[model samples]
Target: LVNGVLVAYGGMVPFIATLAMLASARGLALQITDGKTQIVTVPSVLDLGLPDAYVLGIPPLVLVFAAVTVAGWLLLNRTTFGRRTIAVGGNPEAARLAGIDVRRQRLFLYLLSGLCCGIAAFLLIVLAGSGQNTNGNLYELDAIAAAIIGGTLLSGGRGTIVGSVLGVLVFTTITNIFALNNLQSDVQQIAKGAIIVAAVLLQRRTVRDGT
Candidate 1:
């Protein structure tokens, strides 16, 4: 319920949800790997989309992506639920002392993240033209890195959907530009690593200078 809202209405919620789902699915696979008379394969919704070029295919996805991002921003910035999330993330003890339900908050946070993953998983399959078992590998790392590079604190109290979006854009643009110029994958990887380190250091310097 709460998780559903977060996934549908929060930006990072989907990524979190996807990780949870993958974890659960792996568990299920393990439990049922040898127990069934028949195998059951789950098909995702995005697998059914029509084939088309990137220009045509990208529009609907972009629209859905934009809608999710905007909803996330509104939920985080303009809702009481968002306030409680911030409190819980910022300081669990303080939030509990202020009458917030810490367990509930954490539970919902994870649930919302799972739901977000479902939505994102749908988009990913469509974008990639296939449902792959290893499709989203390391996405969480990229997202977390983008967030950190965009000025989100690792200590977990302050962040924004807008900033995360911009961060993702910056990362993607840099990669795209490098690829267009025929840069090698190893060089691109090195460049990305350097950029992330530089970004983190700058963020720290900014924080220190602000004091």
Candidate 2:
């Protein structure tokens, strides 16, 4: 849809379109919540069904994260759709010339991303017991930083699930270390920005060296 039309007619990059949508969605959510944080109390039955407690000596959330990581690895490494997605991201024109439906693949990728976001939101709400327009503010930066640090090319076509997981671990470790030191949010933001810049520079150097 909307993304297709924006790219076709408006000559907008898909990321820009998505960023616009994110802003709009956040605005709408704020209006719905009357600029107040909305608390969500899960019903006991639903809570019971969900992983509220530890399982197999691991926190349920940790288990869920592991499951998602494994599933992502399998999808990206073992599926035709994943191959097509990489192809499209790497070079859309070439992908189309190779008889791949580039538009369809892009659509599927966006759908998959949205599904992941939905799942993350569900997990966050469950963990926090609340929902707010600001719940994920600036999280896009964290995600991009993690991916790039993990060797996921911002230009696309190259990435590994394991690397991404490692990147997340790196980011988590940094955050925890900062928290332990009682650092300010400003310091955290500065560190994140620095990491993103460093990762991008490293990526450029690697690409230049053809590594």
In lDDT terms, which candidate is top? 2
TM-score of 1: 0.71
User: How accurate locally is residue 5 in candidate 2, as Cα lDDT from 0 to 100?
Assistant: 55
TM-score of 2: 0.91
**What is the C-alpha lDDT profile of model 1 across 44-133, one tens digit per residue?**
444344344235565666777798899989989999888998887789789999998777677777677667878987777665554545
For model 1, the stretches where C-alpha displacement exceeds 4 angstroms are 1-58
In angstroms, the error of model 2 at 48 is 6.6
TM-score of each: 0.71, 0.91
How do the residues 1-211 of candidate 2 rate in per-residue lDDT, one tens digit apiece? Answer: 5665565446688889988988898998899988887777658523623555667667666777898899998999899987987898899899999999877777667677778887888778777777888888988998998898899998988999999999999988988999999999999999889989999999999999999
Least accurate 10 contiguous residues by lDDT in model 1: 34-43
How many clashing pairs does model 2 include?
0
In model 1, pairs of residues that clash are 14-116, 14-117, 16-113, 17-113, 17-114, 18-117
